[model samples]
Target: MEHSIFVMCILAVLSIALANPIFQDFSQLKAVENANKVLQLVDQEVLSNHKLGQQSSLPQKIDWREKGYVTNVKDQGQCASCWAFASAATMEGQLFNKTNNLITLSEQNLLDCAKSYNDKGCAGGWMSHAFKYIRDNGIEADGTYPYTATKQECSFNEANSVGTLQNYVKLTKTTEEEILKAVANHGPVGVYVYMSSLFMGYKSGIFEDDSCTETPNHAVTVVGYVNTPQDQYWIIKNSFSKSWGEDGYMRMKMNKNVCGITYRLYYPIV
Candidate 1:
């Protein structure tokens, strides 16, 4: 029940109009105090939500890229369209899961063509809306419709399409544990995070920000997770090019829903 109060208080603090004295006073201090709440509360063994009897069968770690289930991380350039990259990564994972052939889908197709589906081209977009687009219009191969990272004319050719979504899964009312389970069981999942100034300066290490506000400005893919004797974290594939983070990836500090990672998490079905 202590954890429950913390969660409730934190959520309440997020409100702009909440007149609670704690919200008005010592907000920054309170944020720091709750920084490691998830780390202290969550049992590391429940990382994958495995059944007790089947614990032995669970893999010690999971990184989809190591198994060829993930494609090379691509750059989104100056565009604020990491959402497209996140959605494409999720589709690529789902495609590989079905066909066993790793094929890169076209994020350009979504950028240029999916504006009607609630996409804003280089400005931004949502993964769920992109999935709806693939369901109705299908997605082309990256080779046929490569990413320019800028808004361009929609020249999508259905003949060159290689993947179509049968459906997509969006988990609601989720927690940090549920997000971890989704990444472990469902492969790479689409998740967004706040691109705080501190987060942008991330060079390496399990990234955790005590001052980060619960606001997500960028979308990325959760590739896998690991729990060692020393520490635990989630491996995330970013769209900021291979030079950023750990070769185009970030090992997000797990169990804290750092940067609102738990919200806007979804996976495509192909």
Candidate 2:
């Protein structure tokens, strides 16, 4: 009898732990499900608009040399440090454009080290959190500290790298209006918004609306925007484990009705 009671208690504890709202908030889940519905409607809208062929020319591609290349980081499983991935991608683009140096910086470094700033490397964080760290104390290249995909203590060194970053901008808000404006004016915008299981490992094609938005779980970059006759679409780059989707890219509808935007870029004051 005692053994049976203990076994039942263990199962009950596991069930409750799995049902915890922090791990999966029911309200947010409803929101994402609703957003997915909106996205599905947008899909039909896109099909109708496609009949026109090139309704909106691709927003002017940022002069790779002048502006910056918006890219995504490969998702690190359940590692919550999407904050590190987003932050490093932004820096990689800025550094490349400003110095023309194609150096893969260390997202793992931030993931492991940058903790004092309310960041839980693998647990996820806000883009602003990473940028603030950069502003307060700059960063280094992938060669400097390297990526380990594990958390550690930050050891920032200013002199170990070549060339400090310049002409980098971090947007204030993650609103669709703000992001579209930036995409229209600049080359590509880095953003960090919630993604659903459908978004996980997504490779190519347009992201159809799916009812799943409770947890904004991924980090991606907005490369371009289009105002189709039917609806607006954002050209996005994902960091899935592999290079998928239009050669490692995907399109997301800027459903103002659904909370989508996460981060934007503010042009550096030259």
Candidate 3:
């Protein structure tokens, strides 16, 4: 009976793993033309014209999670608020590094208040624009404003703000080395990437979807990186809840410009 119970426990764990959507096979997942319409709102000209500084040297391995800058994974639900989440996460890291206090900021604040900067809230938005809003008006704490995962009227109150950005700097486009240096020296970075069907179903291992396009449609935070002799990858923190890839995180193949991860990366200066 004891042996049988052990087998049953193992089976239960396997059952739970199989039930996760990320485990589903995506071999037949077709690439959709409009799969990334939300990212089309980004003003490429502004990003391109932005000046970049010299690259700093980066360590072979760095993890912000171990350094205590990363916040808990968040769930955006059905909202296309990846841009807001990414912006807030990067700010949280910067704030923590500055004050040694890890406070969760409100993505809803950006969703509602940053529309003046051309953000469409849950419909779609740009991280660069969100940073501009934060720099100008400041961002409230999650406890003050909170995330509703839906479009709401602006209820911004600067008095309740927990963080503010002095400025934001864009990294050199298509330069993976520069991006690595930025993440290593700074805390986390806000970056855009193509959200392919395979990416949606990613569970584990280094994600290197060849079907991914250069068009970035979703924003996420790059918290760290790993360099193995065989494979190198970027540690990405997603806002899709802890149930997704490696507890709402993903590692994509590094230095290949996978899914335009290196195209437009920016970080806040607090």
Candidate 4:
């Protein structure tokens, strides 16, 4: 009976693997085996809904980069630092939208300092925790703290902080329209999504993997959205360097909650 159960499990894994054509070979991903380890970093409590005012009107299409509020793509390297990257990116967008200055905040600051508040640095972390750390202690500038792509001893200097969050809000899960309105009115928002094998191999085009899981894992930033005649997609900024995806950006199918992109959305108010 045990042997039969083991065979069934293997078959289940194989079936799912065959269903995904985008990433047939898991080896193509840099840290394929560690993908789950990376994704499991998000704190579930942060996924709760928070009361936020609804936007009266939002543009059909909005791009934070074109509006001059987003920073460049960052690389987390071999480390599972998506939480830190997303946090810093969202904060940078908030600061830019408010002050009109594109200042690069320090992901390393969160990777190190935030570990005290249930953050695991490179191993994994929640963006909510990172936001809380920034709100309480403030985050330093990238130039001041710099990113090492690995966990290090906390060396946060409040004196070098160039950005700080007044507060953050957790958007309603699976509410893509609400998330769209938030991103359009505010700046870029930090979001958590299930990183499928196909997502790891995504190169270009609108990503709509039917085989992808809905469980949230990896942290990313939603910068904007574009609506076309045939399809609508969200412009997501990833922390996998400029070489990955469409120059470190992925166009995910909008309104379907693709990979749970709307699941645990958050943005900082600078």
Off by over 4 Å in 4: 1-53
lDDT of each: 0.73, 0.51, 0.77, 0.77
Q: How displaced is residue 18 in candidate 4, in Å?
A: 14
TM-score for candidate 4: 0.83
Q: At residue 203, give the lDDT of candidate 2.
A: 54
Residue 146's C-alpha lDDT in candidate 4? Answer: 92
TM-score computed on alpha carbons, candidate 2: 0.64
lDDT of 3 by residue, 1-270 (tens): 544543343343345436765523321111111222523454552443434445544577999999999999998877778889999999999899989999999999998999889888776777878999999999999998988878899999989988888778875365888787778777699888876656777788889987676456678899999976776999999887988899999999997888888768888888
Cα RMSD for candidate 3?
Answer: 10.7
Model 3 spans > 4 angstroms off: 1-57
TM-score: the better of candidates 1 and 3? 3
lDDT of 4 at 93: 85
Model 2 per-residue lDDT tens digits across residues 98-192: 66665666676667556776666654555555655666666777778776656777776777543343334554344665565555654444675
Residue 266 lDDT (model 2):
33
Per-model TM-score versus the true fold: 0.78, 0.64, 0.82, 0.83
C-alpha root-mean-square deviation, each candidate? 10.3, 11.9, 10.7, 4.8
lDDT at position 12, candidate 3: 38
Q: CA lDDT of 168 in candidate 1?
A: 76
Sorted on lDDT, highest at the top, how do the candidates line up?
A: 3, 4, 1, 2
